[model samples]
Target chain A: MFLAFVAATLVITYFSARKSSGASAYFAAGRRITGWQNGLAVAGDYMSAASFLGIAGMIAMNGYDGFMYSVGFLVAYLTVLYIVAEPLRNSGKYTMADMLAYRLSPKPVRAAASLSTLTVSVFYMIAQMVGAGVLVRQLIPGVSYEVAVVGVGLLMVVYVVFGGMLATTWVQIIKAILLMSGSIFLSVLVLREYHFDLGEFFTRLTAIESTAPDGTKVVRNFLTPGLIFKNPWDQISLGMALLFGTAGLPHILIRFYTVPDAKTARSSVVWAMAIIGLFYIMTTFFGFGAASLMGPDYVQANGGTNMAAPELARKLGGEVFFAFISAVAFATILAVVAGLTISASTSFAHDFFTNVIHHGKEHQPGQEVLVARIAAFVVGALAIVIAIILGPGVNVAFLVGLAFAVAASANLPVMLFSIFWKRFNTNGAVVGLLVGLTSSILLILISPDFMGENAIFPLKNPALLSIPIGFLAAIIGTLLSKEVPSEDKFVEFQVRANTGLGSEKATEH
Target chain B: MNDPQPSAADKPPIDWHRIQRDPDFSALVRSKARLVIPATVFFIVYYFALPIGVGWFPEFMEKKIWGDMNIAYFFALSQFLMAWVLAAIYVVAASGWDRSERTLLAKFGYTSKH
Candidate 1:
């Protein structure tokens, strides 16, 4: 059943790529996408299964605090809207490197930005691949885990290789709509079945708690997991990364470039917000419904609360709902992977190959596009290998938080200061990116999650340390730099990006 | 364009007077400031408010809404909505620009129309 869905998604990609206009079309949808459509695609790209399944599962398992994921996810969009959307639309040449290198020397910034984008994207891609492996295994009763991982990986490569961003964006838009509609429908049905009696649901759940032979009550709350230091602190740090980190994510940020203007970027974000909010609300219900209906024994039997939504659907909607949820889960992986590939490809082609190597202007457009498509295959392959080794046990949602922290700490500071501050030089931009990326990674490594249950790491989230470090690095680096960039390059980037008339106009004037 | 005019009397050694003119430039300054100031203020408030609010209202947040969900859940979810909404708003509001603003932006190497 899952294999069939994967094949269909691949076919969609092949057909979608028939009219491809080469690299720009693949990377930024030819900058022709409408604001609302792009917004939906952006939302699609941003809202992964980690959100749909994980948030609900977390909520069902943890209780009131579990909803922090949704809060963090939603609020992060505001940060993107206010700080990034217009400026990125106005500054970036084609990728993160374009934005950073435009104001400073192209050499170091391009190399650094490309490496950062690739590192984060690959790390993120592994998480998605891991998710794909899990979903495929769970949905199909007979399929082995290895088969599922390879199947999803091959299908993802096909999707990206053929469809590019145009096909990917449309796919995401459709998937987002479907995911939202299905979630809403499921939430409503669950509520109607209970006659809006949430209290009754909880009351029954509480009353059903079993007792041990010693007479101690069975503590069956889903929110509190069996891990050491499984407290609210981990939850809050995870939330900060998801919320603010969304603003800085390379894959999501690149989506803004698809629109023709800053205004469209703005409009897309609005549409994305409305859809995301509605979907989250529905997910909360799904979580609660799964917890109440499936019962702790059943959940424990079927691999814990993470499987709550699927098990509950099996109980309520039966085979059809199960298939539907599983398909949606698969689509979530596809949409996110598509977005990640595009961002990675953009970094390689636009940032490294064209900008750094070509000194911002030597490559034929066609060749550059070809290099990017090739890079996509390589990235996909790497993700597949990592996923196979790591297996499917890792928490994808948490990794997404890590991705955001790296992006926010590294990309956001450089991006924010470059356009607004005149003193920002190339040296400053490069150091800032390096410092931010390094510090965040270091902090995360020492974090409790990375400590491997040893209780050695004192902190859970490095954001408390890294976010400030990123900001400070950018500030101090800029202050210490002596070389000021020539005014022409900054003007050139802004004009080409903002006007969409290309570089000719800037040079002509 | 105004014709160039020069004072016959040697300009004051200290250059006592400075040329200041153009209502449009003034208007541009005001318009730009209007957007920049509020946006900056809002950003600081939103980013800083959550950590502070979470610290201050932990007990209140512990209260439930529907079943297991609570105030913290709602706020967290709303933040995601806010992020996207804010992006959309920036794009919509910043796209339009007058000729002078365009020229000034162009002078700075940014194309004004996009």
Candidate 2:
């Protein structure tokens, strides 16, 4: 089944490669993806292996605290649908930078935006790559971690370098479908185990028996909060990160560009919210199902938290079902990484290489696309090497959290200011990006994740502090700068953003 | 895929200042803001309330409202419903905005095309 999925995706790449020509086609899939298709792709890109394997594992282990992650993830999309998506669709050409550079000076804004984009993407991609390596090594016999990392890296490189956004979109769509099906089926099986009784399922979840690390057997209620997150401030900080972070994600932002217009973009967001909301709700079943059926101790004893879903599948439906769920997890990683690669490469090539270096002028017609393809290769290889060096011992959840922290802090504040605040200037954009990016990373380095008991910052996530700092920096930088806000440009931007007066259109065949 | 004709960059610049001041545009913006601003604030408040409630008042939230289902679990599930409901309302509201956009574009002597 894994081989079949690989073959199917490669076939998709072949077809997309034939059709994906020109910068628009390669970068934005010719702006032709429909509402539901783009919706599925968006969900696919957004729902990484972290959401699937990690969340289930977390819930199986910690219960209600794990479900908190699901709530935050889904709720964050409202920020996207209402504030970010349509304006970004209307104002930006290819990247998140395109929207920022609309009213401000192009070169500096693009440069800062590109740097932040790459930072977030690399942080995110490394986590996924390491996850892929660890998962593949565990699931398949004789597959070493290094080989798995490199293999996944090379496959993502091929997808972005050749087929570009179109193939990546399809891969994500297919993966989303598979993931949804697998979750639904698994949830049904879980319910069947309880005779499809909600009362029975909830009863089982109330008193879950597990053994502690110190060899003491403990009985805990899985339905209660405070199992994993002992710190209220830490939970609030993580909540803020997730609540604001989705709007700032470069990969998710770029998915809006796949649709023809702002209306389609809006519809696509609605579709995605519905799909994503449903999928997350199902996480309740599978997550608690693993806890109730297999027991947290059993899951921990077998292969640990990340193996909760797959182990549940094996127990419920035997080997065949286990293989199917495993393959879906593999597809989930590939789709997410492919989405990340294209967004990073697109920003680097379009924003940095072409606009920053070449002064927004490609010396050759297809030079930008060429540079992006090359960027994909470089980015993929870099991620592979980093993941190998970092090894599977590095905490995947921490890296993912840090990525959200940076996005919420750096990318989001600047993006919101650029669109809404007429006073927002080049100085604000650059300073905001720098301050937000550095503060989040700096805070994390000193936080409990790295510093253990002697940590300077008590919070696990820094968005609660860094996000305010980001917004303040942008405001202060703008007020301090003497750069005259161009009223004409702001007017133009407002007109275009509010009404799709001058938006990118779908490419006709 | 062919290039977009009269792409935003190359198209003849419209009288953007006039459009910004126009009643139709102002109405559209006002209408969207009406739904969006309050909805955004409402959802953000509602969303953060969960963690705050669960974090600060764990004993209260731990009280089972249903068959072994605590208030925390029920509230978390309600978030999914809240998000979907909000999204549906926004989509329905935005369709009106889309119509206003079209009418405004037509008055400006430009045919809006997807």
Residue-level lDDT of model 1, residues A238-266, one tens digit each, is: 65566567776788888887887666777
Q: Per-prediction fnat values?
A: 0.24, 0.72
Scored by TM against the true chain B, the candidates give 0.59, 0.90
Candidate 2 error regions (>4 Å): A393-398, B1-11
Q: What is the lDDT of residue A136 in candidate 2?
A: 84
In candidate 2 chain A, what residue range of length 10 has the lowest lDDT sum? A392-401
Report the lDDT tens digits of candidate 2 across residue range A1-509: 98899899999999999988999999999999999999999999988877888788889987889889899999999999889999999888899998898888888888999999998999899989877887788688899989999999998898888899999999999999999999999999999998999999999888899998899999999998999889898889999999998899999999999999999999899889888999999888999999989899998876677778888999999999999998998899999999999999999999999889998777999999999999999988888998998887554655677799899999999999998898999999999999999999999989988799999999889999999999999999999999977899889889889898877888888
| Every candidate's CA RMSD | 7.5, 2.1
- Supply candidate 1's per-residue lDDT for B79: 60
**In model 1, which regions exceed 4 Å deviation?**
A1-8, A198-236, A303-306, A361-365, A453-456, A487-509, B1-57, B64-114
Q: Please state the CAPRI-style docking class of candidate 1.
A: incorrect
Chain A only: TM-score per candidate: 0.90, 0.98
